[model samples]
Target: MKIFLTLLTSLFLFFSCSTDDDICTDGEGTPQVKIKFKTFATGKPRTLDSVFVAVDYGAGPVAVVQNTVATDSLMLPLRVEDVPFTDIYVATSSTGNLSQIRLNYTTTSEYVSPACGIRRLYTGLSATLQAPNPVLAVETAQNEIVNESKTHLFLLF
Candidate 1:
């Protein structure tokens, strides 16, 4: 009976404790902002011509896309760290015709895991077109960055 009790206690202690190395770290980072493009005339999904994306409002213009071939959807990381808002620059042509979009959101710190630590969760998103461009309209598909499958914005071109 004494040996059985000692083994049971040891098992309980081992199972109840958690270490950073033992924590699951897969898919622990913040979700990226997703955008889908559509045509204004046809109202159907369409791809743009080598759209260039970057963070042009902060510190400097950090290039996110450098002449990306062609795509109807884009998945971009905001700041990676904790930030209240993000400014995204989208350029369609090589002539530097840029369209600036400002995304404002509220952030909350969340505990992911011991290995991943805390991550920022963005919510209550609001977007504003800072510059005039080919984008005719903007739509918000989802406000929070809870999942990467959710489309945060829809651009009509």
Candidate 2:
């Protein structure tokens, strides 16, 4: 009867309405740069006993990695602002010597999805090592950061 039709319509309407849980699960977003440490003499991968990293995203130095144990590679997030460069300080230990590294690049925004929005892709990537001690030199690997699957920079020690 009329009551059955009204209940059916109500159920259909409730089921058809989408909720906020319909989110983007495509894993499409800003990618972090990956850096690997290597031996300066043999040019082989080297593992650090302990590592400390601080990055200046514009405001001040912020500790991103603190006392990481036995890590050969590092994943670093860059600045997404209007700046053209990011400064990072790396140390082998908590009180070890700090080496300053400046990463210079140009960014381009790409539209990923509606939920993910736009992501910044860095190009013309270059690095400068200002201090020499635990970290000696810098080598560019990929030069462009489109994804996080490959090594972007090599820190020679």
Candidate 3:
């Protein structure tokens, strides 16, 4: 009886003191986002007309004017920093899913961004956007960690 009790206590102690491995640890690194666009996004795939690429910048779209290089083959411009994408509306220009533009000009349409501001001039929605909660006052930054059924990650921008 004494031996059995001793063994039971030893097992309980060992199990209780066991350490757990962190399975959901995402190593410390820069938080980055990839902008995925659709094929219909590239206006006039083979033309020299400017195609605006706007970034909402978490608030709304910011105009980044850039023109497409009329390539002999399937070639895409490196970036759009000059075309005037801000507030401009393209029926269906930029894509949510990234893909190469297929010409026939069926998908090519006017570029317009849904930004509300002064007429004849539209601004990106991001400009007037507001963070849900800037900071929890004094709390400044909030980071919650969980190793159970649910895990929440709050990364700083």
Candidate 4:
């Protein structure tokens, strides 16, 4: 035997040219894609095992888009199967990814000096805040404003 006919012709050409779960080509079949998950902030509607979707693809062979019901800001319904041509890089799993929700804040500015003689008159304030999840907007100068000897500096986001 020629090594058993060269191992049965290389296992019949590697099982007739590789493919599992049905694929007759010239017959057309496997092609399903439906990715839906949106809830970055109250767009309302999300559910994919708790909306932490992440797909730069490469996790294919999945199938279950809307298996019944699961969308209330928990977004998740990804079933991108065998791909004839699909390019997806979905997101929404950044509970703390984008630099922990991106935040850059700065503070420490006060120039209140309009008396120009006794050197005891001040009234200048500047505070800045950047966002991804930053919600700090405060302006205080009430009650004729003494600012209580001014000694409060907090930069939080």
Number of clashes in every candidate structure?
A: 0, 0, 21, 10
Model 1, 67-101: lDDT tens per residue? Answer: 65877889988875567789988888766777888
Judged by lDDT, which candidate is best?
2
lDDT of 4: 0.29
The prediction achieving the highest TM-score against the true structure is: 2
Model 2, 138-157: lDDT tens digits are 99999899999999999999
Backbone clashes in candidate 2 total 0
Candidate 4 differs from the real structure by a C-alpha RMSD in angstroms, to one decimal, of 26.1
Compared with the true structure, what per-residue lDDT tens digits does model 4 show for residues 1-157? 9999999999998887644323333313211222233344453334544323232234542322223334432222212233322222222243432211111122222332222211111223222322333222212222111223332222122
Model 4, residue pairs in steric clash: 46-73, 46-74, 46-75, 47-74, 47-75, 47-76, 48-75, 48-76, 112-122, 112-123
> Worst 10-residue stretch by lDDT in candidate 2?
19-28
Against the hidden true structure, what lDDT does model 2 obtain? 0.90
Candidate 2 stretches with Cα past 4 Å from truth are: 1-21, 24-26
lDDT of each: 0.80, 0.90, 0.25, 0.29
- What TM value does model 3 have? 0.18
Of the two candidates 2 and 4, the one with more favorable TM-score, higher being better, is 2
RMSD of each: 4.5, 3.0, 21.0, 26.1
